[model samples]
Target: MERLCFGIDIGGTSVKLGLFTENGNLLDKWEIPTRREDSGSHILEDVAATVKKKIADDNLVRENIIGIGIGVPGPVTEDGTVINCVNLGWGIFNVSEETEKLTGFKTRVGNDANVAALGEMWQGGGRGYKNLIMVTLGTGVGGGVILNGEILTGSNGAAGEIGHITVNPSEEDKCNCGRPGCLEQFASATGIVKEAKRLLDKSKEPSKLREIQHLSAKAIFDCAKEGDALANELVEELCRYLALALSHIAHVVDPEAFVIGGGVSKAGTMLTDLTKKFYENNVLFALKNKDFKLAELGNDAGIYGSAKLIIGK
Candidate 1:
């Protein structure tokens, strides 16, 4: 019988599941709504049920399956004990143990962002590089660090929480985390919009951004591409902070590449180009040559990485 595996990424809204062969080819994928009601107690049961159904529907022998790997949206210890997952209303528990008990399969668990990083390293942008950093710029900034081909979960599973790094102490506004001048305050999608609004409010600069009914990080990048001076300034400012943050990360882990992902990265090459320019300018000489690339796996990175976890890839 052929060896098979299941990769599951549990988010607040939904759970993404992928069935793959031992070599990492995704044979099937699907999702189930995350039942956040009742402290998300129904989540693992739903996942186990779905996995069993998939196996039965596919007529796969139970013994042929290797195990299941899960990516949770919170800090997870090396032993798969999730300290807390507010999004899922979950407290400290051994996710792996519970999942195995429910699914009749061995299980492994990891942080979502860290799992995504592993996914990128295994089959996406970070492929071919053993040391890399993945910075996800969505509603907020999230990061994952890989050193010597392994995820750096840190002693407290907070090793890759790059967004909270303070870049400005004098700023009056506080981040969602209640800190001032965090990297997420300037470089994330929401951060870019916030800065744009602040800039517009502070100045009467005539730019296309002011005319848009609703501003977005993508619009800012688009306007910058069109040579709108104000938009360009915002983009430059955003990149400046991001580059500085990456520089700090470079000095620490010295990864061979930085993989940029998330909604804001949809701006494509310009985003990578500008950020690369700024990163190289700010990075030390030894790290100046590090590569920068956009994430390739898109939303599926988490599942891929989850599978990688149990497959030992």
Candidate 2:
């Protein structure tokens, strides 16, 4: 029976590979450095070579493997065409077709953030919920919306870009996406630190952040836990931005839950609690009772979600 699948997550530094059963169980996992020396022209070739080598090493039957699924850091249409992947130095192309030709199996592909959300929905934080949103608060904010157990890859596969939502139109700075006052400018780990630094630069506030040589999201949150007034204010600001974004999303999809992930989510319940507290106040009463859960799979979410593409769980 075709009960196995391959999952690949292509990152700027490395590629995560996993073998999974149809039931969403991870059988084995590994990683390989991404050779981006040639504009990533060799990435798919390398991934195919690695998958074939693994099958040979394990004496696995090709018939038993359902297919392969991959997640890339860019927009991907339903037919598996990647519009652009700057991190990997890739241009527009049909990723699935190329991957299938190389691996001799059916292939599927999706945006990395979107696929990560699918992973959480399948076997991690959003498990048992058919509808939910996955929010990644790392270097930049990213999101994946799952509605009725399927990823909502809107027109042109750019559906769940919640980070780019405009929050502060009056701000002068431009976001990485070339927009002003995006939600990511306030909610992401880097955004939080940047805001903290900006505050320390202009204001003579007696903040512990001013003393730290290298301010990070962790430091800010830790200081908040220790009763630092300035840190608390920053944390509240970050949560407020997140709450506003969540409120907007809730009004649209009304997901059953919101799964928080990425490096900044390390703050744990404090982050979720604060965001939820603000979220409830702004959103309609019907949307206030949604679950706010921490992501359970961590970095493994990508590979798991990739496998889900093949097993369809």
The model with the greatest lDDT is 2
Please write out the lDDT profile of model 2 over residues 148-258, one tens digit for every residue.
888888889899998998888898899999989999999999999999988878887787887899999999999999999889999999999898998999999999999
Q: Write the per-residue lDDT of candidate 1 for residues 218-285, one digit (tens) a residue.
A: 99999999999999999988888888898998998899999999999999988888888988887678
- The Cα local distance difference test for each model comes to 0.92, 0.93
Off by over 4 Å in 1: none
TM-score of 1: 0.98
In model 1, the clashing pairs are: none
- Residue pairs in steric clash, candidate 2? none
Error (Å) of candidate 2 at residue 53 is 0.6
Residue 51 of model 1: what lDDT? 97
